[model samples]
Target: MPRPPARPRLTILDVARDAGVSKTSVSRYFGPERSLLSESMRTRIEASISRLGFYPDRIASSLRGRRTGLIGMLVADMRNPFTVAMIHGAEQACRARGYSLVVCNTDSDDLLEQRHLDVLQGYNVEGLVVNTRGHSVAPLVARFEAGLPMVMVDRHLPGLACDMVGLDNAQAMHLAMTHLAEQGYRKVLMVTPPIPGISSREERTACFESEALLSGLESELFEVDLDNEPARLGERLAGWLDEAPACRGAILTGNGVVNLAVCQALHQLMPAPLERTGLLGIDELEWCALVGPGISTVEQPVGAMGEEAIIRLLTRIEGDAEAPVHRTFEATLNVRGSTARVD
Candidate 1:
């Protein structure tokens, strides 16, 4: 069989000729200065573009001394609901500002994060929002020094100073721990993934420990492997339940992943551990409500966080040159059956 003929690539000149307008007018209609064209001209250009199927080449426009109008986002783990929410919020904000977004997922790999950063830089994105495992900051710092506007979302580079937008993790910990305490959970166990270099997890774990002390609640921290070792987590939980004081204990998860792991472990236990111990988590999930005796959570303003990160990056890109601004959003507590007090 013969291959189909290639579609003709339309151009601005064709649209201008078809619309009976000057090339400048067509350019203005396609560029950011569309208001310069008269109403009739605008209508004619729109109709002509529709008829000709002409699409403006953003790359060519960038090459001609125009902004690429693209924002890049690097997410450590795309599967996380929080990252998805952040991307959604950032995309909306970028669209509203007449810019597009290019997202790169690192899958929690340091090498992948470095490569994604290089690729995004090659594209000359107007700005970047980074939510990644900040194990290495040298590359990021080099880019920032070279005048790349950036905002760190939910995690911060250790030595580099940049706009950071995320949940007030300390406040989130306080909310979760205090709620558990109010529910008569005297012994609290905080479960998290490894805290090697991620700032958010470390901050949350520290906050949990400090707040637990202040609240007079006996607390212990547990680090779980992300390789889906539910059996190990369950064994630890079972041991904690057997050793710790009776029905007065609860499990607090550092984030959504840990939350799911903890919940799964509890489900496998014989007596349905939810009936005996309180469970609460940070970063709410869609299934939180559907599970038996819904899981309580401190819901981060993920969408707002993402939007704020973009707004801050845009500001920096627009030449806001003051000290880096760090914005921390407050989390909302949603109480449910899992954290209910047991008499």
Candidate 2:
């Protein structure tokens, strides 16, 4: 199939000619000085605009030092429900504030993240909401130091002093550990994706380990590549079960993605692994309750967190000179069949 011919670009001069008015009149009609135009002249411009279907070019307007009313977001992975929910919250907040959000999903690719930063910069976005791996923080730091307003969600970069909104990691871990221990589980394994530069996972894993120690439970932390290491996870899980045959063991996932990966590995390793080992996760998913015996989760207020990120970003954009603030939201425990004691 061939592409359709491109239509000629409409210009302000065209609207002025069609309305039988000067280009300055058309400009004033769209500007704050629109009130100065006579009713008859305004009516003529309106009619011409309706007939021509002329939509003002925002980029051209922005080039003249007008605000684009745009906010940019860079996401680490769009596949995760957490990211999607956060994006939803940010988008709603943006709409409510008369600002447009431009989301660029990095797809967990470091190179794309770098490129997206440049693209968002070129557009002169008023602010940014970032949720991604912090391995390459130099660009973000440079931008932040250069006076670009920013807020981080779920993960905070180590050195960048930017506003951050996230769940209280210590409290969340205490909740997860307490529930498992109360359920009569003596041994727990913490599962997560690679946790080097991602601060959220790092905090969750650390807190889980600390909580396990304080609770006097035997614990081990493991990282798995969900894309290619389910079989390895199965092996580790099978070995873990054998390591403590008499005691009931549970798997504590660091986030929603890890929860899914753990389930996949368990299903492949045995007939029904949830019955053998308790399952709990740090993040909640819509389908969590639908799985066999329903997966329990520590639900983070992702939507609210996302909204708070936008709120904080807007404050910065609006000339809030206070220091970068960090806010942590409380997480709740949702008990389900997966975490129950089978015996």
Candidate 3:
């Protein structure tokens, strides 16, 4: 059978032939000079390429090509609504700039993050915006050292040295704590998500603790693993409710869903939840109003962060800046019925 004639190595020439266009036209159609083609012709070429699964030879193209005009976004957790919002923001900005975005979810794993980075790099993405979960920054440092364009989104490493775009987590947590303190809640308990040396969470939690200490307010920490048994979080909170102080206490939860778990546990543990304890949720909850007492929350400007990340990446890719640029936006504390003044 002659191995099916070696399967006729599919190339741009074959794609152009199948699409009824010159190979050079197809090449130019997919090139950085996209404005040279009409919308209809560009759409046709894209459709043809999609149908043929024709991947351009980046290695050979790189020798002579100017740019891939692509950007990669790496999210540590796609399920988190905040991350989703940020990505949506990035997608909008990327499209507006005539650059396509390739998104990868690492699920908060270093190995997975590294693998995605390698694959994206291999595909010759023009730049990267990453929300990393790992502490081992050697690989990323190597890439940045080799002059690959990169920007950190929502996560920071101490010495890895890269541009960062993130919410001001410390200031955000401090704002939440101050809100509770201002409401005259003597005892406050912060419900935190799992801290595995992830920069954002650690900074926010540390700031909350230190702020509470500085304010001379009584506070304690409780951690729940968000990756595992997210639903079972209610059960853990129920146990805390049983042992917590009876005197009017305010609880500050780290994430939106975690706030629901706390609310659920509060409902089960107390005949009247609000009278027993106050709640101030971190990150806005969709069902905050639907639930009784309407949870208060700190809303991170997730979309803004995403927009900033992509903008910084694009600027780097376009040779606007060679040095790292870091931007931190403060979170807004939205007061609600769940945690009111004690007067």
Candidate 4:
């Protein structure tokens, strides 16, 4: 078979000629050393590039010691609404700052987390955003020691002086306990998923205990497997209702996932349950309002935390040399009939 001749790869010069502009202008449009070019000029260059189907030679540029304009993000799980909102916020920030984002989802798997970190570093990513469980994060520790510009979401790595941006768990716990106490909830039962290597979960648990004692409320916490008998949670809730007087007990959930699990478990009890016991959650769900009497919650600023993490990473990448920082976003409390005391 005869081989056809190959088409030459399009160059920036071709784009410049097509747009009736200089090669330097086209270069400026593509480079990380951003300069303010007129909007009309930018529009013309964009149209010409689109029409010619031009793709820049990023490999060649990187070889010449130029910035790649690439940032990497590591997410523990994509199914959670928190991860989704954070990713969306980061994508928006990257676009606004004229950079590209590469997201890696590890699903809380240690091996996959290591592999993704290696791959992100191999591509010479300018900075990283980590939201992993910190189980098998030794590779991450090495990178941090090597002085990579990085930020951890919701927590700092174990004993590593790293920057972190997340919801204020302590503040949230205080708020939740206070609200529940105000509603005459003398006892609280918080049900959560497995908690071990994740610092955020641990911190919330501690805060819940301390806040309960401080607020003069008795509290009980249960750790359960979501995959196994979810109905067990309902049994626990039933016990709570039986132990405390009517309108004197409440259920406080760990996060959105736990909130849903507890809701499903409590559903079988039906009619009297919602009105009898108070209910509140840490992470706000979109369906909270649609539920019966609406579920109360302490809503974390997911999007803001994501945006701030990127902002902090960018600062480090731009050579801001200072001690590690901790940025915590506030959570808002949404009160509903679910928390109202029946006199």
* Candidate 4 residue lDDT tens string, 154-218: 87777667799988899999999999988878889888878787889899999999999999999
The clash numbers for all candidates, in the given order, read 0, 0, 0, 0
Error of 1 at 2 (Å): 12
Please report, as a residue range, the 10-residue window in candidate 3 with the lowest summed lDDT. 239-248
- Candidate 4 residue pairs that clash: none
Provide the lDDT at 339 for model 4.
90
Order the candidates by lDDT, highest first — what do you get? 2, 1, 4, 3
Candidate 2: what lDDT? 0.87
- Superposed model 3: Cα runs more than 4 Å off: 1-64, 228-236, 242-245, 268-272
Indicate the residue-level lDDT of 318 in model 1. Answer: 88
Show where candidate 1 strays beyond 4 Å: 1-9, 16-48, 228-230, 243-247
lDDT accuracy of residue 73 in candidate 3: 82
Residue 236 C-alpha lDDT in model 3: 57
- Residue-by-residue lDDT tens digits, candidate 1, 39-136: 89889999999987788887777788877778999998899889999999999888766577999999888899999998998887888899988876
lDDT minimum window of 10 residues, candidate 1 = 27-36
Model 4 regions more than 4 Å off:
31-35, 228-231, 244-247
lDDT of model number 1: 0.86
- Candidate 4 displacement at residue 167 in angstroms: 1.2
Model 2: residues >4 Å from true position, as ranges?
Answer: 1-54, 243-245
Spell out the clash pairs found in candidate 1. Answer: none
Model 2: per-residue Cα lDDT over 12-81, one tens digit each: 8999999999999987776535667888998999999999999777577779997667899999899898
Best by lDDT: 2
